[model samples]
Target: MSLAALINQLADEDTSALKTLSLVIDWVRPRPQETIASTLTRMEQLEAALTESLDVHLAVSSRLQSWLDNAQFFQLLSGLGLYSRRGFFKEISERLYERVNPAPADRNNVKDVLFLVFNRKGDDAWIHEVPDEALLKLLGTLWHFSPPALERTRIRVCTQILNAIEMLSIWVAAEELEPNILRLNPRVVDRESAFVALQRELAAFVQSYVRGLQDEDEIHLDHDHALVLIEQCRDEIARLQRRSVTAGSTMALTHLLERLSQTLTRIEHLLDILDPADKEKRTRRSIELFKTLVQASAERHGVRTLWRDNLRLMSRSVAENASDHGEHYIAGSRREYLAMLASGAGGGLIIAFMALIKIQILQLGLGKGVETLWVSLNYGLGFMLIHMLHCTVATKQPAMTAASIAEKVEQGEHGRANARKLAELLVRVGRTQFVAILGNVAVALTVAFAIGWCYTRLEGVPLISTNRYDYMLAGIHPWQSLALMYAAIAGVWLFVSGLVAGYFDNRAAYLDLAGRLRQHPLLRRLLPLTLREKFASYVDEHYGALISNFVFGVLLGVTGYIGYLSGLPIDIRHVAFSSADVGYAMSVFIPGVEAFAMFTGFALLIGGVNLVVSFTLALNVALRARGTRISSFPKLIRAWFQVVRENPLALLYPPADPRPEPLPDNHPHPEAAEAGQPPSDVTDSSPSTEGNR
Candidate 1:
């Protein structure tokens, strides 16, 4: 029952080493709320008990040595350290398969013993907490008590290490030959790559080591050249990773590079274990290798971790595209701020027309499904037209701007100056968003009211019936309706649309859609070369925005229908549309000033919810994708207050001062002028001019 009793029983009986080791591990394992010191103390007690007497030490040591002699260490030493032999997709599938249907255990295999010993979920959590010193001490105690492994066992381990190195080297070389990798470094294909040279060197080293072993000669194996090649391979992988950021990357390319990196690291660890020059160093390395094995074995069936690991790079790629699109939503100057207002007003005019169409569609006694389809078409086509005309939607700005803000946050150093810069950027974004919302609501309401007045004059009747007007009024009542909740739903759609835009942008780059379009056979036959090229260029620039706008419109239109089918209260209430509805309601019947104020107040509240929810979600995702955090929220808040205190109206409008002019292309850099030479770096600073060049 106790550890001392268990050791005594093992000494008396010829128990299997697996059962004995499992019992020992169970006794020494840390309990819940137990500290590492406690676990170390328990390990010390077990060591004392194991070395209590010569007879007991010999008996237990003999059993452990026997287990070592018979058990296959090759798979544990080689396979556990390396990834699955299968490709990335197959490896993922295999992990999932193993989770569902685990293979039968083999007592002869060390892997089975590992699985049995560290079988519980979250085993890696505590195992990782244990310091290297504690692990090394535990390993040292075990090695001291147990007799030395048989000479055959030692040779077999070395052979397995060599085999793993050879296998990993070949895999690395093959991965380097992948098309995505070659695209980044084409020279790798033309010559003997580091991976290939490593493979060749490994083969020679293995042959020499094997020959020396067979002849019983004191052989000195020089792994310097092989290690140098491994470093070179790693440098190439790093270079490819850096290049992928600019050239763009796909899941497959990311997975290949990840696998190559892991394989190369595993080879280095294996080589360390195989070093015979220093037993003490080898023992320490072996403990580290054992810890890696334990952690890997514990997480072997973790599907979520695998998915997260695989998606991290791709998510970053998507976020990068979103951030690029987001920069336009942030206005850095007065001209851009005014341009955003005009854009928002243009979008609002279309939205007012769209609202009238939605009302007409609902008035038709068409079936629910047909009505929903027509409404969706109106919203989708209207939004697409707005995008085509370079108009801005107020609600859509937050999702885009949040990503841009996150990019700035990621670029800033963690200090007071950086926080102040971010605060200034935030103020700019706030003013831009405020003007856009003001434009959208002001223009949509006016247009809708004018349209309603014209219809009433022409037909001698209000555009909306009294009952319908009352219903629209009640729908937007902040206290009496679910207007804010519905607005939040619309906010969620805005966030999703941002991601949709990013995904399409990433897909276009990955697939070279622009190039494909330019080369299309149909385009070649139907249009002139210049026209075809322009069309392709336009698509390349606006593909994501076009798709995302349509999708967002559909999402907004279909929410009420989904709620109707599901018998739920799900729906959306966008600020621009709500303002248009109120305008139509006002045209039918002029409510009291207090009632008008209430309608306007609720519309503004709805807009606030939409902005908050969308920006929060988008900022969270962007930060995670960039692997960064806002340096200090308190500092940022203080900086914001300081800016607001200096000028309360800064959040509504840009400064009166004009934007500073850029230096002419001929203007010399200060350093260059002092040196009396033309500046080599002088080039167009404008984005359009740079792109054209």
Candidate 2:
């Protein structure tokens, strides 16, 4: 089918694509041995008659190729009459390579023509038969081909070349595209030098292509490949303007824009592919795309993870492009890409460990043991000291301040912060570090209590001996409690520490200060003025180490005191609450502390019942966090019955709703706006606004 015929079918003319396909099947597939010969004969006859009197060529090359694969050519001939549309080229290109080999000088010409044929809209009749590498190299070099100095060449030639470039991209990739088309075209090579001519234009084109792909998810990469094609056409305008500032420059740019207008149109094409009626197939495609990007080494740590391929291609193009143009290419690793992971992961783990031990020791009626605590705490602190020392020597964060963040934010134009009400899952990666810290703290408390319990039962001090069996409930002894205490302290501390280190090594943060300090303005945006801020944040994050070690020291101090002095016969209820038995004011004070920290373990026994009951005015100070000045505090307070009821991802990433990806403007929430601060506009269309765009 001709372009006109196909368009007519699309427009509901007498001929439709369905009818065209039906006709081909009826007439073409029957003859197996002589379909190609018959088609050729028919085309020759039509060409002869057309020259004599203009008439349609009654042979379809695209349909013929498709039939060649599955449908027989005879079947197509019976129904469509002579299918002569762009699809024929596509069919041919899929199955065969052009056997012809041209000389060095003619190589570019052949490739350019082939690209034009391959990019034909509607039915691709014969482009698929071309060799992949040869065709790709041809496609890569088109920017270098100089157009004829004619108005039509400016309009038709460039448009066709660009269209073809875009067309072939359906089979290629954005980042994988090569800019060597100009090299193969020879027009650029003949006139311009290797460094300052075609290479420069190729570089800029590469950047534009990559830039088009920005915000296009690498992981959820269901974006239109057609944009890559559209960009090829747009860059042609830029290429022409650079080639000749003399004439038609304005017209060329205008046409380029028109081509780009069709860019996003093909998103429908990809969506259809992803949302196929076959559910099994749809699932498979999603899985394939995810696996490819995830397992890709180019996306790993120590690599410039985000946009690395784009920059690499850009650099190559720039290197090959003209001197002035190549200067426009920018590429490097981003700064502070892994900071949040370090701070949250490192701090959370330590805190969890200490919290567990301390609470347990007190609850078990054991005084805090000092020796083991000091040893573990000291080791953790030493690591923090080293981490801080490294940051100090690096002098990074001050440079990574807001100005740097703004530049990164601009580049990440497509990413919208996932605004939502955060649950525990969002708040604490309890398993990652927060939970580890809490568990360790529990263990530490248990250890101190057990050791104290043993010391209290000793007949005498270490200088004097005592029976180890004093704590026997049945066969178990007091010394066994001390052993259990040691087990808790050593096991909890080491297990959490090692696990955190492994997580840091494996699932690194999005913006870690230490890892990212060196990469800014190159990999990430930076300001000389704010580099100091980065340094300061690094110092603050490292302080968790000091807090951790200090607690560790207290652990050892209590241990020493217990070993030396008999543990006083103390009841936790009396020490913690005081048996007024009347328990008047103590109820008020205890509930407050229990609600927040659950320190008394009574919070667990009653299940935050008292906390929920006593929640009052100050706690209700929150305004409606999101839109329309609607305050849902009462509803939210009631909802905590659920959060307090069912905690989720609390053990993974942060709990901030719209979990930020460790970049600037991380988690701007409804509370942020209510606090007299403008929330991050993720987009002008507030997600909840009535009729919001």
Candidate 3:
């Protein structure tokens, strides 16, 4: 049927209004090509015809009054029990949908219903002039003729129409009399824009409140005034929602509601915090609450929010990579502990040789630019080779293993039992670290001492200049030098390297590095199938480790030269190299046993600082990234005491018979296995590109 005929039948027929309305919607909904202007014209004509055909003003009021006389409809709508109402709404909605079944895909029944109800904007002028009885009847009619109670789209439209009339009714009652001319109110536009601005002010209020609560500062604001303002803003938003029937209006309404809810919740929390309590307990309570809020903000507003899902991928990938490195730090039995010591000794031997090569590189007397490049290459290539050799640098273990520890902590909920497990892990890490340091230093000093003696015998002079030897001794003097601070700085670099490694590893897995490499045009055209596959697999597994090592080398290589150029005391202090330097100094410069003893003690102090700073920073970052909190520092200390008390030997020596331990969680998340642990891989990713000294 034609839309005009459908509308005429709906308005003129004495049949059920609901049935007539449904027939109109089913007839006129699908006109996707219709323009806004044409639609408005058609709707105006229908409204005029409908008004002439049916005495809408008088009949609608009486019909609405009669229908609502018993108040049964209100009971059905607002007070109906949940279970009964669901079925009631379902029956009404199904009857409507069945009439409109086999509807065209592009047909929008909700828009049609809205058009029929609000055929002309001028028709709403009657709402302001009508008496209370007529007004109430008009609202009831709008509700009764509402299309399909369960159709959310249509319901939303109907809500706006009713809400608009309700608002106009309120406005009319407030003004009492009306003028002939319709003039725009500048205040209305200003008020609406101000309402939007108030949303921003409300957000700022939340932030300021949080900050004030944290700092124990006074946040003086009249709560009643704020509440009144929020209500007004809400009212303005409702007005806007009704005036517009577009997706933009819907989104704005939704956003404003969310902000209002969040702001209200925050204000309540702030009030709770500001309430007077015990003096001793108040600060602690506030601090704990602030920490929780900060963590939530970090998760929501920080970098994690931009790539929340990706970080989960990274955490899993890094945890997997760390698990491989972690296994190397753990000794299965006494035999394995001894084997780790041997491996550390081998690592120390290589470092001593690297130190000797560095001295030769310095002696070449190249320009600063060439020297820097050569030194960078010397350290970068040396470290990468050391990693390939499967040896362990004592300081490097912390940066690599921290992720594994964090992952395990994340798997379990916070409790004394979990703390005990962490304590046990710490004990193993401690013993392993001590043994590795012992092996590295003992071999480094011996090998460097041997090299110095051999160079003296071959060249018939001191292997290193006396000035260079003296400078090394001065660098280690704790009080007289910046050695400890430099060690801490190196520790920061170690932490950064760990993050860089994790980031690259995340990229490899996420980007499907191996598959991409194999499918590359150059590789596909030039390489043998087996070789290309092998190369791709190698890069997929080891790219992060390899890149991290090289970058770390470059950072260490240029630091001293950069320090000289910039007139800063910035430098790195690695324990193995420091030990090697001390050994060389002992052979070439130290004249007495007492002097040698003092320098050796100083060197060990530097090593201790390096290990402590790097481990602490790396562990803190990894734990935070995994969202794992240790609960309390005192609890951790207590757990450590308990672990040591139960098995004193576990701290000093490896267990005689090691058994397989169960994974932390019953349904552990599976992670793909990555590459092995590599030594000297802890380097700062950012470094100056300037030449070395």
Candidate 4:
């Protein structure tokens, strides 16, 4: 296994190169670290020399292809060696690609190119659209591919076939596989065949072969504990044994194929069951090897189709469950409760307007406040608009259970636009309507202000006035003439808040109901139907955690709030004030109307706000969780492979983790016999019912 030897030997006769490499792989394809390193360095130098001479990737590639064509050698390389998957893939990627893409126009050559990766476990690594993708990249009518040469094609193809016996073994194993033998996947179909011919072929070969080997002692070694390992020497060994052969003066390809035919027969003869180790250990190693091959070989050499098929399975599984959102995602808004808030504010705005208008009409008749009313309306409208904006951008309060519903639902290519539209819709319907109502609720106060001012002016004294306003703070009362001002403000606050809260709750409920109608598939069958099953599976998957998290937070928040309130010992009370308290100094005040208006407004506002907050929070949580059906499925399955992939464990098993990868690109799929075909249908084990909303 000298560097100079690999280069010199691979440099000549494609057919001879394949045979030599096959021998190198079987007898000395560097498996140990020291051997592998030296081999890589030598290969690198060869590649450098070939590049300097001109373009020799194809020449060198055909030589490597010759090795893959053999069964024993292909299996040894694809299935063994290396802690790093990436490194292994890099080593053989270029050569594999060249083997597959030898010549764009040669049907035999093109088919040969495709065969190089048919059974390899590197799909998650390479080959976007199969078949034509390996031979030519299509863009509209234009196609891209490298030039082809017939140099050593005959000899190379022959040697490649002889060398590929091991690969073929794996290929056969991969092709006729029992669905049950795959990853702990529930989506696998039972022995049903999609292609009749293929199915028959597999049945005939696998069954007959298994039965035929029953009498052979060397058929398997550790049938109970390991994969059967076996060897099959090529027919070339026979010709070499005979000593009546021509080494160089004949059609090399024909001889190579002859060797391939005989070697596979020997492999069948020598079948031995391979040993299996630790349960987790075997799977871990298999997956790790698969991943390494995928990475290094993906870009350069098209990845194995089966690997891509698996990805297609996993990807479709994700897409199926993730299409919709949950009930908890919908949040009730204080803004949507417009009608109720207006019950309070609408009265106030009218009152304020009328009184000011009356004063202005009287002044114009006598001549005197046009500019003043204009400025006041401007200020009031400005404040109202500002408040609405603030609510739209404001962070959720403590009781809010929903987390980023707007963000999650609005993902994908046009995610931003959809989100923007939803936000805008919310603002117009939810916040704007409510604000308008609140504006009306406070209108009467303005009216009271104008009238009181007029009355004071008539008496040559200040009418309704206050030193300062700490609206939420209770301190000294308002001025003597304006005692009604306090009542008016209280009226507005109580009524507006109550209305807003109620509407928030109502809207949350409605939106949640409406969201369900948007499901990808409607449940129109019995309880145990697939859709329901999928739904239940996902819900049940995370039910424990979701419940636990909810319960824990509820208890914590309640305990904390109660404790804080208990710490306060200050007296809290509200004093009742009437028109009599002010006497005639607040002369314009009618006690009955003032009290009636204030109490009614206060009652409605308080109730509304409470209703809105509670409703909004609950619905918000539900809406956010509605679409995640995976929670209904088997939770352990989600994370099984994931756990196997981290650190030390990753060295041995497939990652049984549940981290969902990003979705595929948004490009349109081509119209093929099976366009956008999702692999095996798997039912999730999550519970369909949800408590998130």
TM-score for each candidate, following the candidate numbering: 0.82, 0.21, 0.52, 0.22
The deviation in Å at residue 137 for candidate 2 is 22
- Candidate 3, residues 108-164, lDDT tens digits: the string is 232222334334333233222323433233233434442333243333432332233
Evaluate model 2: give its lDDT: 0.30
Order of models, best TM-score first: 1, 3, 4, 2
Instruction: Please give the CA lDDT of all the candidate structures.
Output: 0.80, 0.30, 0.57, 0.33
lDDT of 4 by residue, 334-444 (tens): 333433344335434433443344334433533113433443343334333333333211111112212233223334123343433333333332333244334443444
The superposed Cα distance between candidate 3 and the true structure at residue 422, in angstroms, equals 1.1
Model 4, position 372, has a per-residue lDDT of: 38
Considering only N, C-alpha and C atoms within 3 Å, which residue pairs clash in candidate 3? Answer: 372-692, 552-683
Which regions of candidate 4 fall more than 4 Å away from where they truly are? 1-71, 76-191, 195-693
Write candidate 1's Cα lDDT for 1-693 as tens digits.
577687777677657777777776777677878777777788788778766766766776677777766677667765674555465578788888987888988988888889888877766777777777777776555544422365666776677677777777777778877888877778986788888888898888878877766777757576778889889989988788767644566777766777788888888877777766777778778777888899888767777766666566566767777877787888877888899999999988999999999998888889989999999889888999999999988988876788788878877854434887889999998888899998899899889988998899899999987778888988888879999999999999999998888888767776667788999999999989999899998898788889999999999989999999999999998999999998888888777989777888888888999999998988988887776888689999999999999989788888786756776775666576677655565545646434423
Q: What are the per-residue Cα lDDT tens digits for candidate 2 across 1-693? A: 443443233234344223443343223221334434444343343334333432222223222222222312111111111111223234244324331432232212322222222222211222222233332332222212223323323233323323333332332223112233332234643453322322234334434443333433423222234345345544653464344221111222322222223322232222332342466654444333222322321112112322333232222221111111111111111112123333434433433334334333433544345443543454345435434433110111111121122222222333432112322222221122333222323333334334444544573332111221121111111242343333233223322232222222212221244455545455345445367557645533443333433333334334435445675431111101111111211222223544324332321222122112211110111110000111343543454345654644433333334544553443355565467454456544555431221
Model 3 lDDT on a 0 to 1 scale: 0.57
Error of 2 at 173 (Å): 18
Looking at model 1, the pairs that clash are none
- Minimal lDDT window, size 10, model 3: 176-185
Worst lDDT window (10 residues) for model 4?
572-581
Better of 1 and 3 by lDDT: 1
